[model samples]
Target: MDVRSSHPLGQHSGSEETGNEEPEQSVQRQSIIPSRMEDVICRLKDEVGYKKSFDVVVREMTLGDTRTAFFMMNGLAKDIALTEVLKRLSYLHGENMTSDALHSFMNLYVPAVQVEPEEDWNKMMTNVLAGSTAMFIEGENRALIIDAKSFPARGPEEPSLERVVRGSRDGFVETLMVNVSLVRRRLRDPRARYEVVRVGERTQTDVCIAYIDDIADMELVESIRDKIKAVHIDGLPLADKQLEEATVRLGWSPFPLVRYSERPDVVASHLLEGNVAVFVDTTPSVMILPTTFFDLVQHVEENRQTPFIGTYLRWVRFLGILVSMFLLPLWFLYVLQPQLLPPNLSFIGPSKEGKIPLVLQFLLAEFGVDLMRMAAVHTPSPLATAMSLVSAILVGDIAVKSGLFINEVILYMAVSAIGMFATPSYELGLANRIVRLVLIVSVAIFKVPGFIVGITAILLLLCFQRSFNRPYLWPFIPFDAKALLNIIFRMPVLESKTRPNLLRPQQRDKMPTGNGRS
Candidate 1:
C-alpha cells in the first residue's frame, strides 16, 4: 500500500519528482487500461478500494463467454436503465463477442445516449467516481464509459429570492443537466451554446459556460474559459460562490461582481443580452458575469408586467434601496445636528435622548433585526409567526420602554429595514447594509464631513470597480444616455432593439430591422 495524502483516492502530486524523470517515463506514468481481465480487476481493486469504500461497486460478469467488469458508484447508477442494458448483454452468445468485442458490445448491447470509449485508466476511474459506469472487456484496450448517473435532486420549485408574479414557476435544481435542459427549453436558437468545462482537480465539478455564439463576443467567452481553466484548486465544495471568488478578482470590495440567479428565464435573458451564464453542478444558482450595479437592482417582475407598471415598480424599488442605505444615517445626522434641518423638518430628530447614544441605538437595532432575520431562517415555518411576534414585542416595544432605544431610532430603523428587504439582490442588500453601518459610525464621529466623505468614497469605489474588466457602474460612470434611460425605465421588449454596447457583442441589433421601429 502506498502512503500518500489523506485524499480518498490517495492521489499524488504530478509535479513531485517530475524533474528527475525522463519524458518517456513521465508519459508512461499515465497508465492505460490493461488488456488482461485479471490484471485490470486486481489493479482497479487496489486503486479504487472496492473493499474499503462501500459505495464503489465493481460488477464482474461473463458476457457472451467474455469476461467484463463494470465500475460505478452504487446509488448514482440508474438501476432500471443499467438493468435494461444488462438484459440485452445477457442475450449475447460466444460468437457475438468473438472479434472486436469492445466495439460490438458498445454498438450492439449498450443502450445509452452518452456512452463513449475512454482509453486512459485515470480518466476511466474519474468517470466511475463521477457516477458514469465504466465497462472494461477482456480483450479491449479501451473502456466504455456509460452515462447512467441519476443524482438525488428536488423538483424545480420557484426560487424564493427572484420570484415573479406572472412567469415560469419552474426554477433551476441542483442537477446540472436538468438546469441546462430548462435553459435549452426556453432558448431554442441553433447558435446558443453550452460549453462544459470540468474544474477542481479533485472534485472535477462540471461548469457550463452558456452564451449565444452569434451574439456574444468570442473574446469574452474565451477570456472566461481561460480564467476557469487556470483555477488550480483541489475542489469546489461550496459550488458557484467558490468558483466566482476564484475566477473573479474581487478584492476587499463588498459589492457583488456577478449576479446570481436560480431562474432560468433570468439566465436566458442575460445570454440574449450577450452576457455569459456560468452553471455549476450540484448548485441551483447560476452566475451571470460582468454584472453592473443596475443589474443587481433590477427584478424579473419588472419584465413580467406592462412597461408603465414595470417602470413604476422599478422606481418604488429604487426608492426602497436608497431609503434602506441612507435613511438611518441621515436621520442620525439630523438628531446630532438639528441646525442642518429646514423649518418644517426641524421636528425630525428624537424628542428625548435615550440612555444609549443615537448611533449605538441604531447599531443595536440593526444587529437585532439581522439576528431576528437569521433566526427566522433557522426556525420552523410553524414557529416563524410566533418568533416574529416575540421579536417585535421585545425589540420594538420593550426596548423603547426600557430607555434602551428612542422612538425616532426605532422608526427610522424600521423604514431602513423595509427598504433593505425590498432590494432585489440579497448580496447587494448586504453590501449596502455594511456601507450604511460605516456611514452611521462616521456620522457618530465627524458629523457632517463624515457623511460627505463616506458617500464620496463609495462613489469612487463603484466608479473604479470592474466586473470581468467591464465597468461595475456602467451606463452611469461611463455615461451612456441611451443605456442609462433603459436602466431607469423598464423599456418594452420591442423598444429594446440593440444588445448592450458595453459587452461589445458581435451582433448589435436584436431584431431583424435596423430602424427605430419595426
Candidate 2:
C-alpha cells in the first residue's frame, strides 16, 4: 500500500453526489488556491502551537526598501550574530537589489555570514529552526539561508562508562560541532573525513558519520549513508534507536550488531579500523557499525591497563556472561534431571521439601530477584540501598523460610543476576535475560540434550547475523587469528598495528613500530 494512501481518511471514497459536484468544485477550487496557501501556513502555525519553551519571532525586513517578512525561533538563534546581519540588511540603499545581490552582500559584507543559495522554502524553514536566517524574494522560488546557529554547547567531558587511565578521557557531547572537534583533535590526519547528514522529518536532527578517508571502505560509507538517508521519523529520540534500526540485518534477532560507546577513543579506534561512527545530535553515545559480539565486550580501558590484567579481566567477563545465561537454567535442569548428574552433585538439592512445585519455586525466586533489580535501578540512590536490603534479606529470607522457594534456586538466581550486570552494554544484558528463559524452557522439556540444542541454535542464529555485510561474530566464526588473539586476550597497544579485519578498512596499518622499540 502507498504510505500516503494508508491513512484512514485517504482510504475512504468520496460519494457519487460529491463526484457530480465537480463542476461547482472546480470553480470554488480556482477561487480558493491563494486562500488555501494562506490556510496552509495558518494550519502549520496552529499545529506548532506557540509554547513558551519555543521562542517564536516574526521579523519584518526591508531589502532596498522592499518589505519582506521572516519568522524564526529565538534562543535557538544567535541573537547577537543575527543582530549584526540584520544591521547590515536594514541599511540596503539600492532599489535594483535582487535576491542574489542581497545574498552576495550578506556573504561578502557581513561577518560570520553563511549563504545558502537557491534553496527550497520548506528546507530553508527547517534551516531557520536550526538557527539559520532565511531570506525570501517576492517573485523567486528560492530563498537564501544564513548560518546564525548559536545554541549553547559544552566541550567533551570524561566518559562515565568507558573510562581509560592512559588514553584520552575526553568523550563526545550532545553538540555535533563539539563532537567533530573532539575527533579532529585526536586524529590530526588530513585523511580523516566527516560527513553530516540531517535526519528526522520534524526534528531535522544533525547526524554525523566520521571515518578516516583512506582507512574506511568506500562501499561501507555508502551503505551507512543510504541507511541513514532512509530513516523517516519525526525525531531520533536516542542514537540507539537509529543505530539499531539502520545497522541490523535481522531485525528480530536479540544480538546487537552495532556497538555503542561514549568514549571518543573507542570511536576513534573504530574510525581507524574502517568502521563508520555515527554521532547523533542531542546524544552523547556514538554508534560504531559492522561490529561483532566481541566488540561490545571489549573496552578502551583494556588497551590502557596492563596486558595481563586486561586479559584476565576479559576472561572474567566472558565467564560472567556464560554464568548469567546458564546458571539458573543449569539449576533448573539439575532439578529436572537429578539422575543425569554425577553421583556427588545430586546431594546439592534442599534437604527440606518445598510445598511449591520445583518449576514454580524457581519462577517465583527469579521474579523476586528481577523485581528487586528493577526497583534498585529505578529508585533513588538512598532508597536503592534500603530496598536492596529489604528485598535481599527480608523478602528472600522469608520466602526461603516459608518453603515457597528453595535456597539453592535463590542462590543461583542471585549469582545469575550479578553475572548479567557484568556486561557493559545494557541492551546485551537484556538479551542475556531473554536467552536465559529460553534455555530454562528447553531444559524443562528435553533435559540436558535440549539445553545443548537450544544453545547451538542461538549460536547458529548469531553466526548468521550480519551488520552491513560484516559477520556478527567477527574474529571468531570467520577466525581471524590475529584479531581473535587481540579480542580474546588483550594485546599491548604498541603491538597492535592493524584494525579489525571484519570491517575491511581501506588502510591496514594504524601505526608502525620503530626499530629497537621492543
Candidate 3:
C-alpha cells in the first residue's frame, strides 16, 4: 500500500549534470534534499520527469548571482501572485544574497501570505504538486513553500438540491479555498479553524477540516483527523463520498452516518452546533461529520420559515421520509395478510393478478424508477420533457395495461417514490430504497415473521451504528426529551439558548444571557 513506487513521471538516468555532487544512485539511496543547485535540479528533473511534462515549470533565476529556481504547476499559480513575487525578487541584488539568503528572502522579500521551510524531498514533491510554489536556491538545504494554491472551479450558484425560498444563493464550489471563505463569511468567529490534510499519495488532493475551536468537541475533531490521516488510498475518485465511507467506518450500513450539504449556511449552522465539516477538493458536497440519524432528516428550509411554518414543513418532510422508507413494505405486508386489514383499509391490496408475484411488482417498479432516474440524469434539458412523456405514456401505462403491474401496485409505488424525492438528503433516500427492498423481500417470503424480523434487524443495525463514536440513533435511543423536541420543532433563533448537550460543545450557551432579544 506504500504508493512510493517508481515515480510515474520519473526518468531515471546517470546524474551527469550533477557536477561534483553525489551520483544519482547515491542520491536515490539517501533520499536527501541536497544543498547544491545543480544536484537539486538534477534530482528533481529525474524525479518530476521534467522532460516528459511541459506544465511542470521550473524557472531558473538568479538572486544576486546565486542560482535559484521557482517551481510551480502552470495552470495553478495565479498570474498576479506569480508576477508580484517575480517583480519583488527581480529587485534583489548585491549583499542581500549571501549564505542563508533563502531565509533572508523569505523573511523580508517574500510577498506570499503562507511561507514555510521544507527540507524533505517527499514533502516538497507533495506541496509543489498541490498547486503551491516552491523556491529553491543554491547552497541551501531548505526550500520555501508558498501556499499559492488556486484550483479550477465554477463560481457559486444556487445549489439545486438544498435551495431555499429565501437565503444566500451561493453554494460550495469545487474549490476548497472558496468553500472555506463561504463558511468564514457567515460565522466570522475568530475561533473558526480550517485544518488541511493531504490525502491520496499520488494525487495529493487537498482535504480541509473546518470547525470552531471552543464550540466543537476537540475529541471529536481529533478522532476525525486521525481517521483521515489513517486513509492510505492511492486516490479518492469519488472524493468526499469515498472519504466518508473510509473515515466513518460505515461498512454495508444502509443508513447515512454523515450528512452532506453544498450550502455554506448549512455547514456554518452545523459548525456552530459543534459538528465538523470536511471539504474535499474538486467536490462541491461537503461532509458534515459525527451526524445523527435525526440530523440528516432536517432541512435548512425549515429554519428559513417562521417557527409555526417551520414546524409544519419539518413534520411534512418527516412524514415523507418515513413513508418513503416504510409505506410500500407495510402495504405489501397487509397484502400478505389481507384478513388483518381493517374494514376501512381493505382496498389496499392488489385486486388483479400478474405474470409476477406481488412482491416482484414492487421490485420491478423500484428498478423501473431507478432506470428513469438514471435516464433523466443523462437526458439533455431540451429532451427531458420528451423523456418524461415517454416514460409516463409508454413505460407506466403499458406496464399497467399489460398486467405486469396492478393499479394498486403502481399507485402505491408512485406514492413511495414521491416520498423518496421529497426527502432532503439524497444519500438517505438511496439507503431508504435499500431498506424498502429488504422489507418487501422479507414480507414476500416469510409473511409476518419475516417482516417482523427484518424490521427488528434494521432497528438493531441502527442501534449499534455510531458516527465517530457518537450514537447514530441519538435522542431517540438514549431518550433525550429536549433534544428530541428540538428535532421535531424548529424553535425561534432567539428562544433557543443552549447548544445541544449531545455534541458536548465547549460553550454551553449559544450566546451570553445578556445577548437575548426583548
Candidate 4:
C-alpha cells in the first residue's frame, strides 16, 4: 500500500533560535531541531539533498490530526517492519492524539525496540543517512529516530586464509554486529565489552574494540581508544589497514604491528589472553593487538591437534618461516665463498654460471615469481590452473633450458616460494620476502660482511620495535625463559593457566575456581 502523501510546497517561516545557539557558527553544526515542519523539510532537502538522491526517501502522511514525515535511506531499513509501523500509526485517531501527539506517537505508534528521541538536527541527519528512519512531527522539537539498520551482508563462511582441518566452520563476516555475536557466542562472560568508536569524518565507519573489562589492561584499551578518537581523517575507505597506518604510524617498517585473523576462535583466544581485538566494519579480518613475532608464526591448526602433534606442526612452521627468510641469501653466501662449504657439502652451488649474472638471476626470479603470483590473483578462478601451468611449464622450463637461469636457481627459488606460502600470516610472509631480498642484495655487494651486517641490522630493528608499547620480539628479546619455551613448543592448553606477562593484564590467573570467569 502507498503510504506517501503529497506535501504542498510552502515558504518556510523559520522559528526563533534558542538563546544559547550562536548565529556565527556554521548552520550544519547547529544542533537545534526546528519546530516548524516546513523549515525541517526545507533544510532536509537543501542540506541532505533528499530531492537529489533517489535513495533518500521521505514518506509524508497525516497521523490523526498531526502531519508526520519519515526520512529514510532506501534499501537500508526493512520494508515489512516499516510497513507494520505505518499500519500501527494508521489506527491513531484525532481524539487520542489531541494532546501530546509526539509522546503518543512514540510510546504507542512505533513498534521497533531500538527507538530513541533525537534533538540535534545534525545527529538526526547522520542517523537517517546511516540506515535509521527519523519521524519529524508537525510541532515537536525533536525527531523520533528508529533503528532499523539492515546492511547487505554474507554468511559467516570459513575464511580462506585461516581455514583448519578440524574446527568450527563459522568465521567472522563483514557485518560488525555479526562478527561481535560470533565472539560473544564463544565467550559468554558479562565482563566482555565491545566498545565502538566512529572514526571517519565523511564515512563515519564503526571500529569496535573488544576486550574483557577486568582482564584487559584498561590503559592499553584507553590508549587505543584515544588514538581512534583522535583520528582526523575524512574517511576510512580501506578500513582496518587504514586505521592501522593512522594509529601505529609505522614509518619504514615492513613487519606487521598487529596480527589479523578472520577466525572468531583466534580472536576469542586472544581476548582470553588479555589481548585486545579491533573489529572494523566491512572487513572480515579482526586485528589482534600487542602481537609479537611468535604470534604471527602461530596457526589455529596447531591447537586443534594433540599437544605432541601441535608441537611438531609448530616446529615445522618455524623451520619453513626461517627458510623463507634466510635460505636464498645463505645459499648465495655459500656460492660467493665456496671455501665456507666443507668438501662433502660443496655440491650446493650451481655447476655452471647462467647467461645472466648470479645476483641478477635471483632478482629476476624473485620479480617473475611475484609477477606470476599477482597475475594468478587477478586471473579468473576457472583460468587459474591454466595460468599456473603456463608459469611453471612454459616460463620456468624455457628460462632454465635457455640458460637464462641455472637449474639450481629455479630449484632454490621454488623452495623459498613454497616456504613463503606455508607462512600462516600473509603480511608476515610478504615482509619476509622483503627481508630475503635485502639480505640477497647485501650478500651480492659486500659478500661475508654484508650478510653479517644485514642479519645484525634486521635483528636490532626487530629488537627495538614495539606494538602498543609491548616489545615486538617479546619473550625472546626480553629473555622470558618460560614464555620463550612456550613459543618454542606448543604446550597443552589446560596446563598453561597464566596470561602473557607482557600484557600485564589486571587478572593474571586464567583458570579461577568458580566457572573460570572474572
- Model 3 quality (TM-score): 0.90
Model 1, 1-518: lDDT tens per residue? 11222223445456545754354344543466777888887887798887688998888899999999888889999888888888888898997764788888888877788889987777888888778999999877689999999888999999999888899999999999999999999988888999998999899999999999888889999999999999999999999999999999888899999999999999998998899999999999999988999999999999999999999999999999999999988988888888989999977877788999777788889899899999999999999999999999865899999988888888888899999999999999999999999999999999999999999999999999998899989899899999999989999998998989899998888887554322
Model 1's C-alpha root-mean-square deviation from the true structure amounts to 4.7
**Candidate 2 segments exceeding 4 Å error:** 1-54, 62-70, 87-100, 136-142, 152-160, 163-170, 233-235, 246-249, 343-347, 512-518
Query: Deviation in angstroms for 371 in model 1?
Result: 1.0
lDDT of candidate 4 over 468-512, digit per residue (tens): 999999899889999999988889978898899999999888788
Ranking by TM-score: 4, 1, 3, 2
Q: lDDT of all the models against the reference?
A: 0.88, 0.72, 0.85, 0.88
**Candidate 1: regions farther than 4 A off:** 1-23, 26-30, 513-518
What's the residue-level lDDT of 460 in candidate 4? 98
- Backbone clashes, each candidate: 0, 1, 0, 0
Assess candidate 2 and give its TM-score to the true structure: 0.82
For candidate 2, the per-residue lDDT at 190 reads 84
